[model samples]
Target: MTALRIDGPWFKDERGRTLMLRGVNLGGSSKVPFSPDGATHNGDRFFNHRDVSFVGRPFPLEEADEHFTRLRAWGFNFLRLLVTWEAIEHAGPGMYDEAYLEYIRAIVEKAAEHGITLFIDPHQDVWSRFSGGDGAPGWTFEVVGFDITKFKETGAAIVHQTHGDPFPRMIWPTNSGKLAAATMFSLFFGGNDFAPETKVEGVPVQDYLQHHYIEAMVQVAKKLSGLTNVIGYDTMNEPLPGYIGIEDLNAPGGIVKLGSSPSPFQSMLLGSGIAQNVGTWKLGITGERKVDTQLVNSSGVNAWLPDRECVWRCNGVWDLDANGQPTILRPHHFTKVRGRRIDFSDDYYRPFANRYAKAIRSVSPDAIIFIENEPRHVSMKWGAQDAPNIVFAPHWYDGFVLFMKSFRSTLAVDFRTGKVIFGSKRIRRSFADQVASFKQTSKESFGGVPTLIGEFGIPFDLKGRRAYRTGDYRDQIRAMDRSMRAIEDNLLSYTLWNYTADNTNARGDQWNDEDLSIFSRDQQTDPTDIHSGGRALAAVVRPYPRAVAGEPLRMAFDIKKKTFFFEFHHDPAIEAPTEIFVPNYQYPEGYTVEVSDGSYETDLVTQTFM
Candidate 1:
């Protein structure tokens, strides 16, 4: 196998054949540790993060071969392998888990045995287990004098475990706009600029946090340095801007408007035990709208340290007035510095991404650095010096399907344009346009670099998990087909959201109620049948041109017709033959193939039509 590299707007092999990557996020549970019951809903044993192990996450070494074989059979040669900050160094700063590192290396080797290539994804949700998500270690909060146990009571965060049963579906994402995550991200990225007076152990908070994160990832690079299959490292998963450039802290924080919505100022007030009325929005088939206003955190929980102060307060953004009421001290503290307007991506995210790239390349010089913009921020301009050997890896989703938990092919809504698309033809066109726009952003802003849709897939347990009981996955298939069609329409490369080995109908990804994994255990009644455990195989398993002989003009697949079509202008200089992955799952009885100008040979054993 030859090494893959970025060349202009497409990925190329060592022989310079244009490559199209199709794969899935290895597993969803990689975000949490395998030991000590790190499931988000398990509140009893989460704080003991110092004595945890991630040896069996994704899957144990013994079970790797079976999973890998299934993936290869489904035609996934590339992977967005997941690793987390907590998985690498959960014990504390400067503490590396040699055992976990060895296990990861072994897993990578096993993946290579089955002809799979992958890039490391340092995955995270809101922030950490303590803050209702997963990524940073528990000690991260402690370093800044935050008590993890009191996060819920202080109105700083909402956790599924502490909040208990009947957990609102998809509410955990709201944490990104809440107090705890917003504050931590602000400090992590802009502590020196936004919170100048807030320090952790005398070191600037921004430097301390970024340094440790880079150091941890560097350790991963050092371990997998010479491995050809490990091509690169993602800068970070869905990096957030926090409140860095919020013109008005009193206004809403992000684009997501489902469930409880609070402004940065309101979040600060709530964390300080001030009861305030915040707007609440609800999502339906039509779209999201402000249903009503509700008073939250009225229990008077203080998400701050006892006798300690809010970091923003210590930074002089706010202070106690003469009557013991909180008052704004510097209204424009984060909005501007020295009379200059601030933009989160240009001012903060870009610098951190460059730093991460440099640190990783210091160990593996030729490694590609995958960069992602903040999920909510508008795209920023990229120049030559921003980072070399980079790939624009942004995430996209079928917003309606993801949030509504239902599929409606006839009616689709475009989140970017806020336009409601009618009919299946229009919906498919809308989705394709949205995805292509990301590629266009890469070319326009970053000098025509390669673009990979880092994350995109549908929730398998849709329509109240009806398929689990009835064994009818028609809805799931339709939803997934719409997303996959978009990928094919743009001729884009992407890794589907995930394939969790431990996915069960009851627990669903071991975090929140997100059951997007393409594989599940309960569905695997027959171990010998490779597709037994797979969910919505009709939508996921499709024919694609793995490696093209020249520049690819267009590619499409008709799932209902069981037909595949690909057209490319042959490049006479390149000797590599075009390789198309023809999955047996898509054509069980064997189907006929057609080519325009070239004679092709079929290799049934490898399932490739060359």
Candidate 2:
């Protein structure tokens, strides 16, 4: 067997090249619970068992080792290790819990023991601690003029609506008031703005926020750099589009506006004051949401349709003001704000990418950078030249047919042909074509840059029985297979959306049910692993290849009987051979086989028992 180096990228060997990206997301939000005594599994408030820990405490090191070993035994080569900005800076700014960093290091080292690669993702849902899930600490929101902790008491629609069970994580994007305010403040404080009022502790707030975030990330990167398999970092989970407004195109002249308003569509900063319609932003405002009928503009009034009604009924953000007139106030930041064709041709996003890349590399140059493009701009035609790295990453979703408005699935209307594909019976064609485009674009974009389907899973445990039929877990897997096969069939790599322990019964509501985790919160000392959702997904993933000294290796599996052909690559070497570990399975007549490499033959049963 040949020893192959696989720190990152696919490992090449003579027999079968092993794709190096069989990965899963270890949900990071459950590190510490808002309620310590609250029902939690592994110290996190969502699950009932203590199998996993999120709140700055170390999950039993032995358990961590076991988890890694299990992942390897199950044929996973990578783990998307998630750590939140909040976890590092929970106490306050300029303070990172040194102990937690050590724990992370231990986890990485343990993972290495199991031959797994680790990619540190600064995970967050809807921005930061103030919004939900984890990222920047709660204090960071104060720079945006809002106390995240106060949202619980203020009865703000965005905050209050999410307080119930099954925390509506990303759903806040459907409304954009509070999120808008927060983003505006972040940009105002972080950007080049030097206004006196925007100062935090006498320093510009934008600078302060960006500084703290980068500092925290640098600390983690430095601590984990020594680990061989630790790859790059996911800079910040889904950065917001900053507070900019877009117009209701259906209005006369297809015109849009640029200002904050409660609406779900993601807004993008076209260039400073100029903006464009992208997707809906989540509204986060304090007190009862005001709705004034007189404010409605008949010329551009968007009637309450069934699909649009939910934005209003669920207390979601809408562009309409309190009186129902469009307002400039836009919601949350960085939800699918992708780099545009124009931006690329003109070279606009490079500065942002360069700055972020530099910050990460300063601490860990050996790490492989994983970059993502906004899905809106990352459609079938887009290519990886737009974003560079060993990992040309992108996300996939089944669109409105699955997640609906709660998710930012856009209605497909071929902008090139002006043909609406959203409500057509040929929807599958649109979906399939988009997926195929990803493969073709990856090759064309970066000359076959290593691509990874960074995200492609869905929320399960919803009340409706029809959800699965409509693409819940099972359907999500099927759709994911469509994308996964696209990657696998194309020899691409990937990591599933998540492996949180919060999925069953929607225990960790903090992640909005996006916790496509495998573990169930069964508190039994040794619970039956009936709901280990990810294990069920194992069938879809291809196994890792074993190679030696730069020669390819071949291994065959009997899917029907769960067995492996543990033969080495063809080599005319010395006589004796050693036995290798193969998948255990039942052979009714007791196993017996002959090993041959065309020129030689070996009989195992006739060999010595000792």
Candidate 3:
């Protein structure tokens, strides 16, 4: 595989052919520890974080060939490979997991052998496994005065490990506004400005955390930068702003209002052992609304360790008053830095992104930096001051389908206006328009750089696992086709959310009740066939222009019609023939091609049209 470089909105290969960086996230289960059976449902040895490992996450090296073969057969030449900060530096600060690093190198090398190109995705959610999601190491909480064991009791986080089975669907996102994750994200991104007094080993926690995280990724670069298949590195995955831009601490600031919806002040107060009746919410068809009030931390469980006080309290964001009662000191601590309000992406995320890019490129100078901010937020605009070869790699998902775990092609709700869309055509148009808005943002905000939908997909276990039970994937196929149509309409490059080799319908992606993996072990009836357990193969495995000779004008595939249409202008300068992957699955009985001009040839064995 030849190395790729960004040329305006298209990825150009070494042969000057425009390339599409399209594929799937290596796996979803890579988020948790491979050992300790750390699939969120099992709380066994939950806090024994330092001793865990993630070497076999997507799969052990022994099974790499099988999974890679499947992905290759699906026409995935590019991958957004998932790696976590906790996976690398879980032992302690400056302690790199050499074995795990070697394992990743082996995986990358193996992927290169399979002709797959990938960028390292430093994946995280909310914060870490102990904080209701996975990413940062457990010691990150310990060093900053958090007791991981008490997160659940104090209502600081909704941990699936301790919260046990029947964990509410998509409730893990609520952790972004809770005590544990919010505090960690706040300190990680804004500790220097927000918590100047709080330091780790005489250095500000923000600096310490950032330094360690970038260096941890550098360890990966040290191991795999030499591999040609390793294309670049993502700055961070779906970064959250915590309380960075909240004007009022009394109201819920997150989009997700499920479970115990605690306000910023309430979360701070709860971490300090204050009892509060937090609003519990359930998402109705219209929107998320408060349903009832639940008394949280009635037993007075402090989230901070015995030797420490709340970072917010110590920083004077809140403190005790004359009557020995806690009171808010500065209500707008996060929102207003000095006098005026601050933009999270502009102020905090950009600086961190620059720093990370510089650090990564110091080792691998040619590494392209993939930039992404918190989902839904417009990140800082790039300029002469920022790093070069940067790609705007933000994430998106069909919110309705993802959260609700149900799909109806005929019914759709507009996210911006909250208006209901009717009919299949209108619904499809709505999805395309939404994605077009995202692409237009990249053009207007990022100075016309290349863009990739770093993550987007539907949950396979929709409507109480109907497809899994009946083995009829019509809904799954339709849902997937709908998303792919939007991507194709925009001609945008993307890596679908996942391809978890060890995924099972029961455990989901093995964490947080998310069952988005295209393949699952539970559905694998035939071990001899590589594509046995694939869900919605009709839509997922489809035809596409692999390497265009020149600028691509339009691309579309009608799944129902079993037809693909692509239009592009050929660049006469490049003599290399154009390549399109017309999958055998789409036309297993054989097919014909009609070109506007020039000659063409088809290779059935390689599944290519040249």
Candidate 4:
């Protein structure tokens, strides 16, 4: 395998043949530690952060061969392998885990044996495990004067471990807008600007957090520097904006209003023991709607330390009146600095991304930098000079299926326009057009760089976990097929959301009840069968052009008819034969190949048709 590089909106191999990447996220459990039961539902070890190990994340080194072989056989040559900030420096600041680095190097060596190429992903959701998701360390909260144990009582965050059984489905995302996550993200990205008075160990909180994060990843890079299979690193996963540019903290009707919608001011007061009535919304067949209002965090527990005020309060954004009531001192504090409208991307995210790229390249000059925008916001103003060697890696999901957890073949919702589309023909077209928009953004905003759909997949436990008992995965198959078809329709490169080595029907992805993994041991009734452990294999395993002789014009796959079609204009300058992956799982009895005007051969062992 040759090292991949960007060449004007396409990936080119060492021999310079245009390449398209198709892969899966190595594992979902990479977000949590492998030892001490770090699963989010296990609340016993929430605060014991220093005494943990990530030795077996993604999978132990001993079990790497099995998982890597399975992924390669499924026609995945590239992988978005997950790593974490906590995994590297869980002990504390500046303490690198030498043993974990050795284990990771061994795993990368194993991946190379299967001809697998991967880029490291510093995965996170919301913030950290202690605050409803996973990514940063627990000490991050403490250093900022937060008490992790009281996050729930103060309505600062919602965690599955503390909330207990029958967890509220899809509620973890709301934490991004809450006090704990919102404040952390604001301080992490804009502390020097938004909260000038806040600091951790006498250093600005943003610099402290971002510096530690980039350095931790640099340690991994230094260990895997000479490995050709380890190509690049993602800056971060799903970066959030965290109340950076809100006009009014008391205003409602913001971008995200899933459940318990609270304004910035409301969130600040709620965390300070001021009970307030917040509006709650619910998702239904007709989209989201406000159902009722409830007074939450009624226990009046403050999330901050005793006598230590909120970061925003300490900055004089708000204050406690003489009667001990919170009052808004500076309503326009975050909205503007000196009469200029603040854009989180242009002002904050872009600078941080550039800084990360420079730091990583300083260690390994040839490493590629993968960048992503905020999940809910529009594309930022990017340019060629922003980062030298960069790949535009943004995530997209079928809003209807992802949020509703049900498949509707004839109905689809366009989240951008908020219009309900009808008919299967229109639905497929809508999906393709929506995905194509990402490529357009790359060209228009980022100088026509290579685009990869970082994360996209369906929940395996859709329709209330009906497939687990019945063993009928037709709904799951249809949902996955639709998403894959959209990707194929655009000739786009992508890495599916995940393949969890330890996923089960009971626990889902070890974090936040997400069951998106394509493989699970619980379904592996027959160990000898390579495809038995897979969920919805019919849609997941399909033919794709691994390497093209020229620019690929079109590619499509039909799941119901079991037919594959690819069309590409041959480039006369290239002599290499275009190779396509023909998985045996998709064509059990063998199949015939037809090419437009070329000689081709088939390798049965590798299941590739040239």
Best by lDDT: 3
What TM-scores do the predictions have? 0.97, 0.64, 0.99, 0.98
Residue-wise lDDT of candidate 4 within 354-393, one digit each (tens)? 9998888888888888888788774888886787778889
What ranges in model 1 sit over 4 Å off? 292-294
Stretches off by above 4 angstroms in model 4 are 252-255
**What is the Cα-based lDDT of residue 475 in candidate 1?**
87
* Per-residue C-alpha lDDT of model 3 across residues 179-219, encoded as one tens digit per residue: 89999999999999899999999999999999999999999
Considering only N, C-alpha and C atoms within 3 Å, which residue pairs clash in candidate 3? 128-133
Q: List the pairs of residues colliding in candidate 1.
A: 128-133, 154-301, 154-302, 154-303
Cα lDDT, all candidates: 0.85, 0.45, 0.89, 0.86
Ten-residue region with minimum lDDT total, candidate 4: 251-260
Expressed as tens digits, the lDDT of each residue in 263-380 for candidate 1 is: 8888888887788798888867666688889887778877776866678878888877999987888878888988999888998988998899999999999889988878755378
The model with the greater TM-score, 3 or 4, is 3
lDDT of 2 at 1: 22
TM-score: the better of candidates 2 and 3: 3
lDDT of 4 at 39: 82
Ranking by TM-score: 3, 4, 1, 2
Select the stronger candidate by lDDT from 1 and 4.
4
